[model samples]
Target: MLKWIAVAAGVLLLAAGMVPLAIIWIESRQARQAGGMEPHVASAQPARRGAVVVYFSRSGNTALAARHIANRLDADLHALEVPEYALGLRGLAHSALDADARRNDPARLRGIRPRTLDLRPFDTVWLGSPVWFYSPAPPIWAFVEHNRFDGQRVVLFNTYNSNIGDDQIAAFKARVMARGAASFEHRALLRGRMTRQIGPDEMLRRIDADWLAGDAVRAPLTARTPAPAAP
Candidate 1:
């Protein structure tokens, strides 16, 4: 009886370990199929002549999306670095705690100083961040808080593991607009366990079709009204 119980326990543990591996394999195969089936197209013209993509990516997933956006828009790319919080397991734990704090008390959140990049020449800025705890990563908030976007177009992008609720989007947008962004747009990619989430090709399509096409931009510029003729 003792032997049977030990065997059962071992089998259960092995199966548990194999579950994640199997899921990964299946997702990888699906990703390959999606990649093969998707066709590439020329990137659309930028909304403005000068543009830049600034992003913070810990797992490289957000970086991939930022690269695609920058390439499609023919813009410069910049990565935000947080060396102290990007090292290993301890770093990851620190990041999670920071994210939680930011979510709860955004005004009090600090640290994560992004490298300074000149934004004066750029009229359009693409900001990207990985979703942490249903909020934009703390590094992203730090970068945005330190920058000025007055009279500039700001487009936001977020990559998530599974879910990205509307409330998170609203919160992020409100924060950016408060910084004096003239216009705002956003796109999100779902990177869940199943592999059909927006890959490179899909991301390009979304950028061209939804973002570059101006569908995502909120509050279009209103034309100046002609003054009534003096009577």
Candidate 2:
């Protein structure tokens, strides 16, 4: 069941089959949230065999959170890189188009494809990406398409500037659930145009399982951020 769901999640992200961005943009978010475990430091010991972090960051916010999580958990990390686009809005735009195109033509997707990430080797995969148009970034969609996640714990981390990330997280949950992951959880780190507060540990602690059940992460923390439009 999980094998099929994991493959489907990645495949769906990889293919649109003539679907447009609006529709894809509209029906966003998936994957249920995992609850119950306290955000304790991953003891100096290694996690289950396949403990790792695979992420895509356009604005660096997601990257920051990914690295922090990796450090706290002492997990292997893999960053999704696209050679052409550097980062920021331009990268976000490119990612948006890339996902749209892939939705239409799965084969059109390109760029470094790893022989394998070996999910079989890890017990959990902390997947990260920046939210775009209320959905996930293209490279992550591509990552999902390329890798196989069987019986592994699949957790999602996202960074967003536009909206608070409710829709985006929801969509991610749906996608992962379809993949039949061993378990899944989604958390959005507030950054970029969004006012970021709370330490990594606190953020992890705040990510209670109940919040995963619904879009109730936190109320807006309106701190004066650097130059940028509202999200």
Candidate 3:
């Protein structure tokens, strides 16, 4: 009887895992359909210590991190938006589908805010986003693709529940470098799962200790931390 119970448990676990995989496949097909997804353009300008922190957040983790960086650096802050990915389960489904779809086509972003990014003024650009489907969110990719980072330092940052794989990091780094960024670096923090989530104060403390040491490197941060699950 115990052996039979163990077999059933294993089958249940496998079924649970397959459910999401099936959902992802279905979402991918839908995303590929016409009127499924679209892209948007950002506005641009020039200006003259100058830095900017731009990010997109679904659960506010990345947004909080962005605010902390902006305050610490006295840099300008801009938020990216995707109306389709609003705050709910449906929104989350859309986000997951978009991330999955991006693995192939990398669709242009639609309904994202601040249509333009003026890289001329800022010497350093900090791009922040939450990791989705083990990758940088689609909006971030669209923003990066639409802009040129010539002669400026580009730093990528993320707030995640689990980990951003090395391959994703390497790919993002290559993309930024290809865009003519003078330099590139990354920083990330693990906030744990939603139940035992890390608070804003503690998260900032980790950021200070790990990334924002002083005026010297006053630039960027993102990485992987062992955690219960994903965000």
Highest TM-score model number: 3
Could you estimate the TM-score for every candidate?
0.66, 0.56, 0.72
**Ten-residue region with minimum lDDT total, candidate 2:** 27-36
Would you list the rank order by TM-score, best first? 3, 1, 2
The candidate with the higher lDDT, 1 or 2, is 1
Backbone clashes under 3 angstroms, per model: 0, 18, 12
Stretches of model 3 off by over 4 angstroms after superposition: 1-49, 107-111, 214-231
Model 2 ranges with Cα > 4 A deviation: 1-50, 88-93, 99-115, 164-171, 178-180, 192-231
Best by lDDT: 3
Q: What is the lDDT of every predicted structure here?
A: 0.69, 0.57, 0.74
Please report the TM-score between candidate 2 and the true structure: 0.56
- Candidate 2 lDDT tens digits, 1-231: 999999998889767643444332322210111121222233245544446878865444456556556654556777777864453345435667876675565456557434247667777788888766566666676676667677777887775555644654665566666665777876665533433334434544443332233431222223224357778
| Residue lDDT tens for model 3, 1-231 | 999999999999999877756544533433343122111112122233478889987666677677777766667788898888876557767888888888776564555776668867888999999898788898888788878899998889998877787888888888888999999989988878644667666887897788778444333323323346766
Judge candidate 3 at residue 136 and give its lDDT: 89
**On a 0 to 100 scale, what is the lDDT of residue 170 in model 2?**
68
